[model samples]
Target chain A: SQELEQSPQSLIVQEGKNLTINCTSSKTLYGLYWYKQKYGEGLIFLMMLQKGGEEKSHEKITAKLDEKKQQSSLHITASQPSHAGIYLCGARRNRDDKIIFGKGTRLHILP
Target chain B: SQTIHQWPATLVQPVGSPLSLECTVEGTSNPNLYWYRQAAGRGLQLLFYSVGIGQISSEVPQNLSASRPQDRQFILSSKKLLLSDSGFYLCACSPSGYNEKLFFGSGTQLSVL
Candidate 1:
C-alpha cells in the first residue's frame, strides 16, 4: 500500500486567496518534511516537523502536524503567484530516516 | 554549507547507447547518496541508495545500476539506454549514518530518442 497520500492532486486559486493542502499517512510519521519544486528545477526544502502539535511558518505559508502523526496540513494565507508549484510531503517512521513521499499536490496561483 | 552537483543538465541519447550520470556532494562527509528518476508529471521513484562507499541498495529492479566510489560521489549507469530511461534524474544526499532530510542536486534531464 502507498505509505503517504495527498489530497486534491490539483488546485487552482486566484491570487490572495487562502488555500490548504493535506497529507495523510498509513503509518505514524516520526518526522514530516515539506518540499516545493518548480518546473525543470530541483526540489527546495520548505520545512520539517518532528513533533505532534508542531506548527511552523515561513512568511505566508504555515504547516501543522497533528499529534497523531498520521496527517498534516499546509496552509497558505493571502497566497501569491509565487506559491504556484508542486508541494510534496515526506514521512519518516519511528527512527528510520528513510522518507516516503506523497504523490504531491500541483498548485496553480492565477493573478 | 553543502552543495550537490549533477552534470549534463540535459541529454539526448538514442536507443542501445550507453549512459552515465554523475552526482557529487561537497562540504559534508559520509553522506547517504541516492539516485531517483521522475517521469514526466509523475512523482519521484527511488532507484538506488548507498550508505557508504561500495555499499549500494537498490529499491527497484531496473536496467540501471549505481556505484559509489567515493564518500561523496555516486554514479548511475546503463549499458544500453532504453526508451523508458527518458525522464528527469535526480541525485540526493542525506547526512550519512542517519535518516536526515535529503539535499537534492539540480537534476539532469535525459531524453532517449
Candidate 2:
C-alpha cells in the first residue's frame, strides 16, 4: 500500500487558471515535501513543511500542511504553461525514515 | 553549494550482463544518499538508501544491490540484469536526515534488451 496518496491523478487547465493538488498520508507525516518533474526529467525540489499546520509559498505556488500533517495541498495560482509538469508529494515519518511518495498529479496547461 | 552527478545518461544492456551506476556528491560530507527508479509516467520508487559509508539499506528486494564505498560515493550494481529493470534511475542526496529537500541528479535512462 502507498503511504502517501495524491488525488486527481491528472488535470488540465487553461493558462492563467487556478488548480489544486491534494495529498494524504496513512501514517503521521513528520515532514511533507513537494517536487515537480517534467517528462523524462529528474525531480526539482520545491518546498518542505515540518510543523503541523505549516504553510509555505513559492511564487505562484502555495502549499499547506494540515494540523495533523496527515494531509497537504498544493495550490497553483494563475498557472502558466511553464507550470505544466507532474507534481509529487513525498512524506517521511521522521528525518531518518525513507520518504514515501504519492503517485503524482499530472497537470497540463492549455496554451 | 552541493551538486550530485550521475553518468551515462542512457544505457542499453542485455540480460545476464553486469551493471553499475555511480553517483557522487561534491561540497558536502556524510550526506544521506538514495537511489530511486521510476517507470514511465509514474512516481519514484525507492530502491536503496545509505546514511553513511558501508551502510546501504534496500527498500525493495530485487536482483540489484547498492554499495557505499566512500563518504560521498554510492554505487548501484547487479550481476545479472533483468528486462524488468528498464526504467529511469535517479540518484539523490540530502544534507542530513533532517531536511526533506533531497537534491537529484539528471538520472540515467536504462533499457534492458
Candidate 3:
C-alpha cells in the first residue's frame, strides 16, 4: 500500500508572505495532483504533474515534482486571504493504481 | 463541459440506520466515477471507483458500499451505519485514463450519532 506524507500539518502565514508545502510518497509516483478545499467543501483542482521533474504554475501558486518522482512541492508566492484553505496532494498507488491522498496541510493566511 | 450533482448537502443518522448518497454526472459518457471520504483532520480516502455502469471496485473494506447503476450515476449505500462512519463524503469524476484530472462534487457531510 502506497502512502503519501505531507509536511507541516498546518501552516499560518501573514498576507503577502510566501510559503511552501511538500508531499512525499512511499513509492514511485505515477501521477501527482494538487487540490485546494475549504474545511467542508469540494476540492478545487490546482495542478497535475505526470512526468518527473515537471513543474506548473497558476497565478501565484507553483507546483513541482522532483526528478525522482517521489516528492512534490507546492509553493505560494505573495499569499492572500483567499489562499487560506486545506491543500491536499494525491497520487496513484502502485498496487491498486487508485488515487490516495495525504492528510493535507491546513493553511491560514492572516489579513 | 461536465457537472456532477450530489444530493442532500448534509445528513445526520443514528447508529444502525441505513444510509444512501446519490451522485450523478452530466454531459459526459463513460466517465470514471469515484467515492471518497474525508475524516475529520484527515485526508481524503478513496472508498470506491467505477469505470462503467454496473462495475465497481472497493478500495477499503468497511460497512459502506457503492453501486453504479447507470453510466452517469454512482450511489453509496450502507445497511447499518456506525459512529465511525461520520465524515465528509465526496463524489468525483474523471476521464477514463490513469492521469486525467478529477472534478469533485460539493460533498455531503454525514454525521452518525
Candidate 4:
C-alpha cells in the first residue's frame, strides 16, 4: 500500500511570514492533490498535480510536484489567518487507483 | 454543478446500536463515489468506494459496511456501533474516467458511546 508523510506536523507562524509544507510518498505518484480543512469542516480542494515537475498556484498558495513524482510541496506566501487550517496531501498510484491522504499539517497563524 | 450531499450533520448513538449514513450526488451521472473517515487528529481513511451502481469496494475490514443501491446514492452502515467508529465521516464524488478531483460533502460527525 502507498503512504504519504507530511512534514512539520504542526506549524506556527506570523501572519505575514511565508511557510512551506512538504508531502513525500513512499511510492511513485500518479496524481497529487492538496486540500484545506477548517476545524470541524470538510476538506476544500486546493489543487492537483499529475505530471512530474509540474507546479500550480492559486492566489497566494503554490504547489509543486518534484521531478521524481514522489514528493510535493505546498507553499503559502505572506500567510494570513485565513490560511490557518489543516492542509492535507493525497496521492494515487495510478489514474484508477484509490487516493490516500497524509496525516496533514496543522497551520496556525499569529496575528 | 456537481454536488455531494451527506447527512445527519452529527450523530450520537450508544454501543450495540445500528448505524446508517447516507450520501447522494446530484448534477452528475455514473460518477465514482467514496466514503472516508477522519479520526481525531488523523488523516482521512478510505472506507469504501464504488464505480457504479451495485458495485462496492471495501478498503479496510471493520464494523461497518457499505451499499450502493442507486446510481448516485451510497450508504455506510454498521450493525453494532463501536467507540472506535466515532469520527468525521465524509462522502465524496468524482467524475467518471480520468478526472479524479473529488468534491466532498459537509461530513457527518459520528460519536458512538
Q: Candidate 4 at residue B70, lDDT?
A: 97
List candidate 2 stretches off by more than 4 Å: none
DockQ of each: 0.60, 0.64, 0.70, 0.74
lDDT head-to-head 1 vs 2, winner: 2
- DockQ ranking from best to worst? 4, 3, 2, 1
Summarize candidate 3's per-residue lDDT along A86-111 as a digit string, tens digits.
Answer: 99999975423777899999999998
lDDT values of the candidates? 0.89, 0.90, 0.93, 0.94
Query: Which of the CAPRI classes, incorrect, acceptable, medium or high, describes model 4?
Result: medium
Clashing pairs in 3: none
Say which prediction, candidate 2 or candidate 4, comes out ahead on TM-score. Answer: 4
Model 3 over residues B17-79: C-alpha lDDT tens digits?
999999999988899999999997767899999999999999899999999999999999999
Clashing pairs in 4: none
Specify the highest-TM-score model's number.
Answer: 4
**Candidate 3 overall Cα lDDT vs. reference?**
0.93
Q: What's the TM-score of each model vs. the native?
A: 0.96, 0.95, 0.97, 0.98
Chain A TM-scores, per candidate, are 0.95, 0.96, 0.96, 0.99
Off by over 4 Å in 4: none
Top lDDT: which candidate number? 4
**Residues B1-113, candidate 4, lDDT per residue (tens digit)?**
78888999999999999999999999999999999999977789999999999999999999999999999999999999999999999999888975578889999999998
- Superior candidate under TM-score, 2 versus 3: 3
Q: What pairs collide in candidate 1? A: A97-B99
Candidate 1 chain B, run of 10 with poorest lDDT: B93-102
